[model samples]
Target: MSTVLEILHIARFGLAGVFLLGGGFFVLAGAIGVLRLPDFYTRLHAAGVTDTMGSTLILLGLMLIAGFTLLSVKLALVGLFLFLTSPTATHAVANAAHKAKLKPLLGTYRQTRKGDNEGGSQ
Candidate 1:
Protein backbone atom coordinates (compact mmCIF):
# COMPACT_ATOMS: atom_id res chain seq x y z
CA MET A 1 0.00 0.00 0.00
CA SER A 2 1.00 3.60 -0.44
CA THR A 3 2.41 5.60 2.49
CA VAL A 4 -0.77 7.71 2.68
CA LEU A 5 -2.96 4.59 2.75
CA GLU A 6 -0.77 3.04 5.40
CA ILE A 7 -0.97 6.16 7.48
CA LEU A 8 -4.73 6.18 7.16
CA HIS A 9 -4.94 2.60 8.29
CA ILE A 10 -2.73 3.30 11.30
CA ALA A 11 -4.82 6.32 12.20
CA ARG A 12 -8.02 4.29 12.05
CA PHE A 13 -6.65 1.60 14.35
CA GLY A 14 -5.26 4.22 16.71
CA LEU A 15 -8.61 5.94 16.93
CA ALA A 16 -10.32 2.60 17.51
CA GLY A 17 -7.91 1.87 20.33
CA VAL A 18 -8.66 5.19 21.94
CA PHE A 19 -12.38 4.56 21.79
CA LEU A 20 -12.03 1.06 23.21
CA LEU A 21 -9.85 2.29 26.08
CA GLY A 22 -12.27 5.12 26.82
CA GLY A 23 -15.19 2.70 26.89
CA GLY A 24 -13.35 0.42 29.27
CA PHE A 25 -12.56 3.33 31.56
CA PHE A 26 -16.18 4.44 31.67
CA VAL A 27 -17.36 0.92 32.45
CA LEU A 28 -14.79 0.61 35.22
CA ALA A 29 -15.75 3.96 36.66
CA GLY A 30 -19.41 2.96 36.59
CA ALA A 31 -18.64 -0.22 38.48
CA ILE A 32 -16.77 1.77 41.11
CA GLY A 33 -19.66 4.24 41.36
CA VAL A 34 -22.16 1.44 41.87
CA LEU A 35 -20.04 -0.01 44.65
CA ARG A 36 -19.23 3.22 46.46
CA LEU A 37 -22.39 5.25 46.08
CA PRO A 38 -24.50 5.67 49.22
CA ASP A 39 -27.96 4.71 47.96
CA PHE A 40 -29.84 2.66 45.44
CA TYR A 41 -30.95 5.66 43.39
CA THR A 42 -27.46 7.10 43.11
CA ARG A 43 -25.99 3.75 42.18
CA LEU A 44 -28.71 3.19 39.64
CA HIS A 45 -28.04 6.58 38.10
CA ALA A 46 -24.34 5.81 37.77
CA ALA A 47 -24.96 2.38 36.32
CA GLY A 48 -27.60 3.51 33.90
CA VAL A 49 -25.84 6.50 32.39
CA THR A 50 -22.39 4.97 32.22
CA ASP A 51 -23.60 1.61 30.97
CA THR A 52 -25.24 3.19 27.97
CA MET A 53 -22.34 5.49 27.19
CA GLY A 54 -19.72 2.84 27.77
CA SER A 55 -21.42 0.22 25.59
CA THR A 56 -21.98 2.72 22.85
CA LEU A 57 -18.32 3.72 22.81
CA ILE A 58 -17.17 0.12 22.85
CA LEU A 59 -19.51 -0.82 20.04
CA LEU A 60 -18.37 2.19 18.08
CA GLY A 61 -14.79 1.02 18.42
CA LEU A 62 -15.77 -2.43 17.24
CA MET A 63 -17.63 -0.99 14.31
CA LEU A 64 -14.59 1.01 13.34
CA ILE A 65 -12.50 -2.13 13.29
CA ALA A 66 -15.18 -4.04 11.40
CA GLY A 67 -15.44 -1.32 8.76
CA PHE A 68 -18.10 -1.49 6.05
CA THR A 69 -19.23 -5.05 6.60
CA LEU A 70 -22.22 -7.07 7.69
CA LEU A 71 -20.70 -7.39 11.14
CA SER A 72 -20.54 -3.62 11.49
CA VAL A 73 -24.18 -3.36 10.40
CA LYS A 74 -25.18 -5.85 13.05
CA LEU A 75 -23.17 -3.99 15.64
CA ALA A 76 -24.91 -0.76 14.68
CA LEU A 77 -28.29 -2.39 15.15
CA VAL A 78 -27.30 -3.73 18.52
CA GLY A 79 -25.99 -0.33 19.58
CA LEU A 80 -29.25 1.28 18.53
CA PHE A 81 -31.23 -1.29 20.46
CA LEU A 82 -29.23 -0.74 23.62
CA PHE A 83 -29.31 3.02 23.21
CA LEU A 84 -33.09 2.85 23.15
CA THR A 85 -33.65 0.19 25.77
CA SER A 86 -31.18 1.04 28.50
CA PRO A 87 -32.66 4.39 29.46
CA THR A 88 -36.16 2.96 29.26
CA ALA A 89 -35.21 0.13 31.58
CA THR A 90 -33.53 2.49 33.99
CA HIS A 91 -36.60 4.72 34.09
CA ALA A 92 -38.86 1.74 34.66
CA VAL A 93 -36.76 0.57 37.58
CA ALA A 94 -36.64 4.02 39.07
CA ASN A 95 -40.41 4.38 38.72
CA ALA A 96 -40.99 1.06 40.40
CA ALA A 97 -38.72 2.06 43.27
CA HIS A 98 -40.56 5.33 43.61
CA LYS A 99 -43.94 3.58 43.67
CA ALA A 100 -42.65 1.24 46.31
CA LYS A 101 -41.79 4.26 48.50
CA LEU A 102 -38.03 3.98 48.16
CA LYS A 103 -36.59 7.39 48.74
CA PRO A 104 -33.09 8.69 47.98
CA LEU A 105 -30.91 10.02 50.77
CA LEU A 106 -31.42 13.72 51.07
CA GLY A 107 -29.10 16.34 52.60
CA THR A 108 -25.38 17.02 52.68
CA TYR A 109 -22.57 14.48 52.93
CA ARG A 110 -19.21 15.65 54.25
CA GLN A 111 -15.96 13.70 54.18
CA THR A 112 -12.82 14.82 55.97
CA ARG A 113 -9.30 14.09 54.80
CA LYS A 114 -6.79 12.16 56.93
CA GLY A 115 -5.07 15.14 58.48
CA ASP A 116 -8.19 17.23 59.07
CA ASN A 117 -10.77 16.14 61.63
CA GLU A 118 -12.77 17.19 64.72
CA GLY A 119 -9.50 18.14 66.41
CA GLY A 120 -8.97 20.86 63.76
CA SER A 121 -5.47 20.29 62.24
CA GLN A 122 -2.80 17.83 63.38
Candidate 2:
Protein backbone atom coordinates (compact mmCIF):
# COMPACT_ATOMS: atom_id res chain seq x y z
CA MET A 1 0.00 0.00 0.00
CA SER A 2 2.77 2.41 0.88
CA THR A 3 4.66 1.46 -2.29
CA VAL A 4 1.55 2.12 -4.36
CA LEU A 5 1.13 5.57 -2.87
CA GLU A 6 4.76 6.36 -3.60
CA ILE A 7 4.38 5.22 -7.20
CA LEU A 8 1.28 7.30 -7.68
CA HIS A 9 3.06 10.39 -6.43
CA ILE A 10 5.94 9.71 -8.81
CA ALA A 11 3.57 9.25 -11.71
CA ARG A 12 1.84 12.52 -10.94
CA PHE A 13 5.15 14.34 -10.86
CA GLY A 14 6.22 12.79 -14.16
CA LEU A 15 2.96 13.68 -15.85
CA ALA A 16 3.17 17.20 -14.55
CA GLY A 17 6.69 17.53 -15.91
CA VAL A 18 5.64 16.26 -19.33
CA PHE A 19 2.71 18.66 -19.50
CA LEU A 20 4.88 21.60 -18.53
CA LEU A 21 7.53 20.71 -21.11
CA GLY A 22 5.03 20.21 -23.92
CA GLY A 23 3.38 23.51 -23.07
CA GLY A 24 6.71 25.25 -23.11
CA PHE A 25 7.45 23.93 -26.62
CA PHE A 26 4.07 25.08 -27.89
CA VAL A 27 4.80 28.54 -26.52
CA LEU A 28 8.19 28.56 -28.15
CA ALA A 29 6.77 27.58 -31.53
CA GLY A 30 4.04 30.20 -31.27
CA ALA A 31 6.60 32.88 -30.49
CA ILE A 32 8.61 31.89 -33.53
CA GLY A 33 5.53 31.98 -35.73
CA VAL A 34 4.70 35.49 -34.59
CA LEU A 35 8.19 36.69 -35.37
CA ARG A 36 8.58 34.96 -38.75
CA LEU A 37 5.16 35.26 -40.38
CA PRO A 38 4.38 37.95 -42.94
CA ASP A 39 1.39 40.38 -43.09
CA PHE A 40 -1.01 41.49 -40.37
CA TYR A 41 -3.49 38.67 -40.83
CA THR A 42 -0.82 35.98 -40.73
CA ARG A 43 0.86 37.57 -37.76
CA LEU A 44 -2.43 37.79 -35.94
CA HIS A 45 -3.10 34.15 -36.73
CA ALA A 46 0.26 33.24 -35.26
CA ALA A 47 -0.39 35.35 -32.19
CA GLY A 48 -3.82 33.79 -31.73
CA VAL A 49 -2.34 30.30 -31.91
CA THR A 50 0.23 31.30 -29.36
CA ASP A 51 -2.34 32.88 -27.10
CA THR A 52 -4.66 29.88 -27.19
CA MET A 53 -2.33 26.87 -27.11
CA GLY A 54 0.45 28.57 -25.20
CA SER A 55 -1.65 29.74 -22.29
CA THR A 56 -3.69 26.56 -22.16
CA LEU A 57 -0.59 24.36 -21.87
CA ILE A 58 1.13 26.61 -19.31
CA LEU A 59 -2.00 26.77 -17.19
CA LEU A 60 -2.53 23.02 -17.46
CA GLY A 61 1.04 22.49 -16.27
CA LEU A 62 0.50 24.80 -13.33
CA MET A 63 -2.69 22.96 -12.44
CA LEU A 64 -0.97 19.61 -12.60
CA ILE A 65 1.92 20.70 -10.44
CA ALA A 66 -0.49 22.25 -7.97
CA GLY A 67 -2.45 19.08 -7.28
CA PHE A 68 -5.73 19.38 -5.37
CA THR A 69 -5.55 22.74 -3.69
CA LEU A 70 -6.77 26.33 -3.78
CA LEU A 71 -3.97 27.10 -6.21
CA SER A 72 -5.21 24.45 -8.61
CA VAL A 73 -8.74 25.82 -8.30
CA LYS A 74 -7.53 29.30 -9.11
CA LEU A 75 -5.55 28.01 -12.07
CA ALA A 76 -8.64 26.23 -13.35
CA LEU A 77 -10.57 29.48 -13.22
CA VAL A 78 -7.86 31.32 -15.08
CA GLY A 79 -7.70 28.60 -17.72
CA LEU A 80 -11.43 28.89 -18.27
CA PHE A 81 -11.13 32.63 -18.64
CA LEU A 82 -8.32 32.30 -21.17
CA PHE A 83 -10.25 29.77 -23.24
CA LEU A 84 -13.25 32.08 -23.41
CA THR A 85 -11.35 35.29 -24.11
CA SER A 86 -8.73 34.18 -26.63
CA PRO A 87 -11.15 33.34 -29.46
CA THR A 88 -13.36 36.33 -28.74
CA ALA A 89 -10.40 38.66 -28.88
CA THR A 90 -9.18 37.11 -32.12
CA HIS A 91 -12.61 37.49 -33.69
CA ALA A 92 -12.85 41.11 -32.56
CA VAL A 93 -9.52 41.92 -34.17
CA ALA A 94 -10.52 40.21 -37.41
CA ASN A 95 -13.77 42.18 -37.50
CA ALA A 96 -11.87 45.39 -37.01
CA ALA A 97 -9.60 44.50 -39.92
CA HIS A 98 -12.59 43.78 -42.11
CA LYS A 99 -14.14 47.14 -41.23
CA ALA A 100 -10.89 48.83 -42.21
CA LYS A 101 -11.05 47.25 -45.72
CA LEU A 102 -7.74 45.50 -45.45
CA LYS A 103 -7.34 42.88 -48.15
CA PRO A 104 -5.94 39.47 -47.31
CA LEU A 105 -2.97 38.27 -49.33
CA LEU A 106 -3.88 36.03 -52.23
CA GLY A 107 -1.96 32.96 -53.34
CA THR A 108 -0.96 32.36 -56.97
CA TYR A 109 -2.11 29.17 -58.65
CA ARG A 110 -0.45 27.05 -61.38
CA GLN A 111 -1.45 24.00 -63.36
CA THR A 112 0.60 20.79 -63.12
CA ARG A 113 -0.46 19.33 -66.45
CA LYS A 114 0.83 20.70 -69.79
CA GLY A 115 -2.60 20.16 -71.44
CA ASP A 116 -4.32 22.29 -68.78
CA ASN A 117 -2.48 25.44 -69.88
CA GLU A 118 -4.57 25.61 -73.10
CA GLY A 119 -7.75 26.01 -71.07
CA GLY A 120 -6.25 28.73 -68.87
CA SER A 121 -5.55 32.38 -69.76
CA GLN A 122 -2.72 32.88 -72.25
Candidate 3:
Protein backbone atom coordinates (compact mmCIF):
# COMPACT_ATOMS: atom_id res chain seq x y z
CA MET A 1 0.00 0.00 0.00
CA SER A 2 2.79 2.42 0.90
CA THR A 3 4.58 1.58 -2.33
CA VAL A 4 1.42 2.19 -4.29
CA LEU A 5 0.97 5.55 -2.64
CA GLU A 6 4.53 6.51 -3.42
CA ILE A 7 4.12 5.50 -7.05
CA LEU A 8 1.00 7.58 -7.29
CA HIS A 9 2.73 10.57 -5.80
CA ILE A 10 5.58 10.21 -8.26
CA ALA A 11 3.16 9.93 -11.11
CA ARG A 12 1.38 13.07 -10.09
CA PHE A 13 4.67 14.90 -9.87
CA GLY A 14 5.63 13.73 -13.33
CA LEU A 15 2.31 14.79 -14.72
CA ALA A 16 2.66 18.21 -13.17
CA GLY A 17 6.10 18.56 -14.67
CA VAL A 18 4.77 17.65 -18.07
CA PHE A 19 2.01 20.18 -17.84
CA LEU A 20 4.43 22.90 -16.79
CA LEU A 21 6.72 22.14 -19.70
CA GLY A 22 3.85 22.06 -22.14
CA GLY A 23 2.49 25.33 -20.86
CA GLY A 24 5.86 26.96 -21.15
CA PHE A 25 6.12 25.82 -24.72
CA PHE A 26 2.70 27.22 -25.48
CA VAL A 27 3.69 30.58 -24.07
CA LEU A 28 6.83 30.55 -26.18
CA ALA A 29 4.79 29.77 -29.22
CA GLY A 30 2.52 32.69 -28.46
CA ALA A 31 5.47 35.00 -28.22
CA ILE A 32 6.77 33.75 -31.51
CA GLY A 33 3.40 34.15 -33.11
CA VAL A 34 3.12 37.71 -31.93
CA LEU A 35 6.47 38.40 -33.50
CA ARG A 36 5.89 36.57 -36.76
CA LEU A 37 2.23 37.02 -37.55
CA PRO A 38 1.44 39.43 -40.33
CA ASP A 39 -1.36 41.36 -38.69
CA PHE A 40 -3.13 42.22 -35.48
CA TYR A 41 -6.02 39.80 -35.80
CA THR A 42 -3.82 36.80 -36.37
CA ARG A 43 -1.62 37.82 -33.48
CA LEU A 44 -4.69 38.15 -31.31
CA HIS A 45 -5.70 34.62 -32.22
CA ALA A 46 -2.31 33.29 -31.29
CA ALA A 47 -2.14 35.17 -28.01
CA GLY A 48 -5.71 34.36 -26.99
CA VAL A 49 -5.42 30.65 -27.69
CA THR A 50 -1.96 30.10 -26.33
CA ASP A 51 -1.79 32.44 -23.34
CA THR A 52 -5.07 31.43 -21.75
CA MET A 53 -4.57 27.73 -22.26
CA GLY A 54 -0.98 27.77 -21.15
CA SER A 55 -1.81 29.71 -18.00
CA THR A 56 -4.73 27.44 -17.15
CA LEU A 57 -2.79 24.24 -17.70
CA ILE A 58 0.15 25.41 -15.65
CA LEU A 59 -2.08 26.54 -12.83
CA LEU A 60 -3.97 23.27 -12.84
CA GLY A 61 -0.78 21.29 -12.68
CA LEU A 62 0.49 23.41 -9.84
CA MET A 63 -2.74 22.92 -7.99
CA LEU A 64 -2.50 19.17 -8.36
CA ILE A 65 1.00 19.18 -7.02
CA ALA A 66 -0.10 21.44 -4.18
CA GLY A 67 -2.54 18.80 -2.95
CA PHE A 68 -5.59 20.67 -1.71
CA THR A 69 -3.77 23.23 0.34
CA LEU A 70 -4.56 26.93 0.51
CA LEU A 71 -1.96 27.53 -2.16
CA SER A 72 -3.74 25.10 -4.41
CA VAL A 73 -7.01 26.97 -3.89
CA LYS A 74 -5.32 30.23 -4.68
CA LEU A 75 -3.79 28.83 -7.80
CA ALA A 76 -7.13 27.48 -8.91
CA LEU A 77 -8.69 30.87 -8.37
CA VAL A 78 -5.98 32.53 -10.41
CA GLY A 79 -6.58 30.10 -13.20
CA LEU A 80 -10.28 30.82 -13.09
CA PHE A 81 -9.65 34.52 -13.27
CA LEU A 82 -7.37 34.09 -16.22
CA PHE A 83 -9.87 31.90 -18.00
CA LEU A 84 -12.46 34.58 -17.58
CA THR A 85 -10.40 37.58 -18.56
CA SER A 86 -8.06 36.44 -21.29
CA PRO A 87 -10.62 36.09 -24.04
CA THR A 88 -12.39 39.26 -23.11
CA ALA A 89 -9.15 41.15 -23.14
CA THR A 90 -8.14 39.67 -26.45
CA HIS A 91 -11.46 40.59 -28.00
CA ALA A 92 -11.25 44.11 -26.68
CA VAL A 93 -7.84 44.56 -28.19
CA ALA A 94 -8.88 43.13 -31.51
CA ASN A 95 -11.95 45.29 -31.59
CA ALA A 96 -9.94 48.34 -30.86
CA ALA A 97 -7.54 47.47 -33.64
CA HIS A 98 -10.39 47.01 -36.04
CA LYS A 99 -12.00 50.27 -35.01
CA ALA A 100 -8.70 51.98 -35.53
CA LYS A 101 -8.74 50.75 -39.13
CA LEU A 102 -5.74 48.49 -39.01
CA LYS A 103 -5.71 46.45 -42.16
CA PRO A 104 -5.48 42.72 -42.20
CA LEU A 105 -2.65 41.28 -44.21
CA LEU A 106 -4.01 39.81 -47.38
CA GLY A 107 -2.33 38.58 -50.57
CA THR A 108 -2.75 41.87 -52.34
CA TYR A 109 0.40 43.02 -54.05
CA ARG A 110 -0.56 46.49 -55.19
CA GLN A 111 2.69 48.40 -55.19
CA THR A 112 2.51 52.17 -54.79
CA ARG A 113 3.81 54.01 -57.82
CA LYS A 114 6.31 56.83 -57.46
CA GLY A 115 4.67 60.10 -56.39
CA ASP A 116 1.37 58.28 -55.79
CA ASN A 117 0.98 60.26 -52.56
CA GLU A 118 -0.83 57.57 -50.60
CA GLY A 119 -2.22 58.64 -47.16
CA GLY A 120 -1.79 62.25 -48.30
CA SER A 121 -3.70 64.87 -50.24
CA GLN A 122 -3.71 64.58 -54.02
Candidate 4:
Protein backbone atom coordinates (compact mmCIF):
# COMPACT_ATOMS: atom_id res chain seq x y z
CA MET A 1 0.00 0.00 0.00
CA SER A 2 2.76 2.39 0.96
CA THR A 3 4.67 1.57 -2.21
CA VAL A 4 1.62 2.20 -4.33
CA LEU A 5 1.07 5.55 -2.68
CA GLU A 6 4.70 6.46 -3.22
CA ILE A 7 4.49 5.61 -6.91
CA LEU A 8 1.39 7.70 -7.35
CA HIS A 9 3.04 10.61 -5.62
CA ILE A 10 6.11 10.40 -7.82
CA ALA A 11 4.03 10.04 -10.97
CA ARG A 12 1.94 13.07 -10.12
CA PHE A 13 4.96 15.26 -9.52
CA GLY A 14 6.74 14.05 -12.64
CA LEU A 15 3.74 14.60 -14.87
CA ALA A 16 3.07 18.02 -13.36
CA GLY A 17 6.67 19.05 -13.96
CA VAL A 18 6.50 17.94 -17.56
CA PHE A 19 3.32 19.89 -18.17
CA LEU A 20 4.76 23.02 -16.56
CA LEU A 21 7.92 22.77 -18.65
CA GLY A 22 5.94 22.35 -21.84
CA GLY A 23 3.81 25.35 -20.98
CA GLY A 24 6.92 27.39 -20.34
CA PHE A 25 8.27 26.47 -23.75
CA PHE A 26 5.04 27.54 -25.40
CA VAL A 27 5.28 30.90 -23.67
CA LEU A 28 8.90 31.29 -24.72
CA ALA A 29 8.11 30.51 -28.35
CA GLY A 30 5.25 33.01 -28.30
CA ALA A 31 7.55 35.68 -26.93
CA ILE A 32 10.14 34.95 -29.59
CA GLY A 33 7.54 35.03 -32.35
CA VAL A 34 6.22 38.34 -31.13
CA LEU A 35 9.72 39.79 -31.18
CA ARG A 36 10.73 38.35 -34.56
CA LEU A 37 7.55 39.10 -36.44
CA PRO A 38 6.70 42.60 -37.56
CA ASP A 39 3.26 44.28 -37.55
CA PHE A 40 0.45 44.38 -35.05
CA TYR A 41 -1.63 41.45 -36.30
CA THR A 42 1.30 39.06 -36.27
CA ARG A 43 2.27 40.09 -32.78
CA LEU A 44 -1.33 39.63 -31.71
CA HIS A 45 -1.27 36.13 -33.10
CA ALA A 46 1.77 35.26 -31.05
CA ALA A 47 0.31 36.68 -27.89
CA GLY A 48 -3.04 34.97 -28.40
CA VAL A 49 -1.62 31.56 -29.13
CA THR A 50 0.66 31.70 -26.14
CA ASP A 51 -1.91 33.10 -23.77
CA THR A 52 -4.45 30.41 -24.57
CA MET A 53 -2.32 27.28 -24.80
CA GLY A 54 0.41 28.19 -22.36
CA SER A 55 -1.97 29.24 -19.65
CA THR A 56 -4.10 26.14 -20.10
CA LEU A 57 -1.18 23.79 -19.73
CA ILE A 58 0.31 25.72 -16.85
CA LEU A 59 -2.97 25.82 -15.00
CA LEU A 60 -3.56 22.13 -15.58
CA GLY A 61 -0.15 21.34 -14.17
CA LEU A 62 -0.85 23.52 -11.19
CA MET A 63 -4.14 21.78 -10.60
CA LEU A 64 -2.38 18.45 -10.61
CA ILE A 65 0.13 19.76 -8.14
CA ALA A 66 -2.63 21.06 -5.94
CA GLY A 67 -4.60 17.83 -6.04
CA PHE A 68 -8.15 17.50 -4.69
CA THR A 69 -8.49 20.60 -2.64
CA LEU A 70 -9.92 24.09 -2.60
CA LEU A 71 -6.82 25.30 -4.36
CA SER A 72 -7.45 22.86 -7.19
CA VAL A 73 -11.02 24.07 -7.43
CA LYS A 74 -9.83 27.62 -7.57
CA LEU A 75 -7.34 26.74 -10.25
CA ALA A 76 -10.04 25.09 -12.31
CA LEU A 77 -12.26 28.12 -11.98
CA VAL A 78 -9.41 30.34 -13.02
CA GLY A 79 -8.78 28.14 -16.02
CA LEU A 80 -12.41 28.32 -17.02
CA PHE A 81 -12.37 32.06 -16.68
CA LEU A 82 -9.31 32.35 -18.83
CA PHE A 83 -10.69 29.97 -21.41
CA LEU A 84 -13.73 32.15 -21.71
CA THR A 85 -11.86 35.43 -21.66
CA SER A 86 -8.62 35.02 -23.61
CA PRO A 87 -10.09 34.62 -27.05
CA THR A 88 -12.65 37.33 -26.46
CA ALA A 89 -9.98 39.74 -25.35
CA THR A 90 -7.84 38.87 -28.34
CA HIS A 91 -10.71 39.44 -30.70
CA ALA A 92 -11.56 42.73 -29.07
CA VAL A 93 -8.01 43.99 -29.40
CA ALA A 94 -7.74 42.84 -32.98
CA ASN A 95 -11.06 44.43 -33.90
CA ALA A 96 -10.04 47.70 -32.31
CA ALA A 97 -6.78 47.63 -34.24
CA HIS A 98 -8.65 46.96 -37.44
CA LYS A 99 -11.03 49.82 -36.79
CA ALA A 100 -7.98 51.97 -36.14
CA LYS A 101 -6.71 51.02 -39.64
CA LEU A 102 -4.02 48.48 -38.78
CA LYS A 103 -3.11 45.97 -41.45
CA PRO A 104 -1.70 42.48 -41.36
CA LEU A 105 1.48 41.29 -43.09
CA LEU A 106 0.24 40.77 -46.61
CA GLY A 107 3.63 40.02 -48.21
CA THR A 108 3.01 42.25 -51.19
CA TYR A 109 5.31 44.99 -52.44
CA ARG A 110 5.02 47.73 -55.02
CA GLN A 111 7.16 47.50 -58.15
CA THR A 112 10.14 49.82 -58.13
CA ARG A 113 10.67 52.44 -60.83
CA LYS A 114 13.84 50.68 -61.96
CA GLY A 115 11.76 47.67 -62.94
CA ASP A 116 9.10 49.80 -64.68
CA ASN A 117 11.02 49.82 -67.95
CA GLU A 118 11.07 46.03 -68.12
CA GLY A 119 7.32 45.89 -68.82
CA GLY A 120 7.49 48.12 -71.97
CA SER A 121 8.06 51.41 -70.06
CA GLN A 122 5.09 52.33 -67.94
Give the alpha-carbon lDDT of every model: 0.82, 0.76, 0.76, 0.81
Candidate 4 error regions (>4 Å): 108-122
Candidate 4: Cα lDDT at 38? 55
lDDT of model 1 at position 63: 93
Winner by TM-score:
1
Model 1 per-residue lDDT tens digits across residues 1-122 = 69999999999999999999999999999999999976678899789757687998899999989999999999999998888888988999989888777766655434323323332212
TM-score for each model: 0.86, 0.81, 0.84, 0.83
Question: After superposing candidate 3, which stretches have Cα over 4 Å from the reference?
Answer: 108-122
Regarding TM-score, does 3 or 4 come out ahead? 3
> lDDT value for candidate 1?
0.82
True lDDT of residue 104, candidate 4: 53
Against the true structure, candidate 4 reaches a TM-score of 0.83
Residue 96 alpha-carbon offset, candidate 1, angstroms? 0.2
Those runs of model 2 whose alpha carbons end farther than 4 Å from true positions after fitting are: 108-122
Candidate 2 vs 4: which has more lDDT: 4
lDDT of 2 at 27: 81
- What lDDT is reached at residue 96 by model 3? 79
**lDDT value, residue 117 of candidate 4:** 37
RMSD value for candidate 1? 7.4
Ranking by TM-score: 1, 3, 4, 2
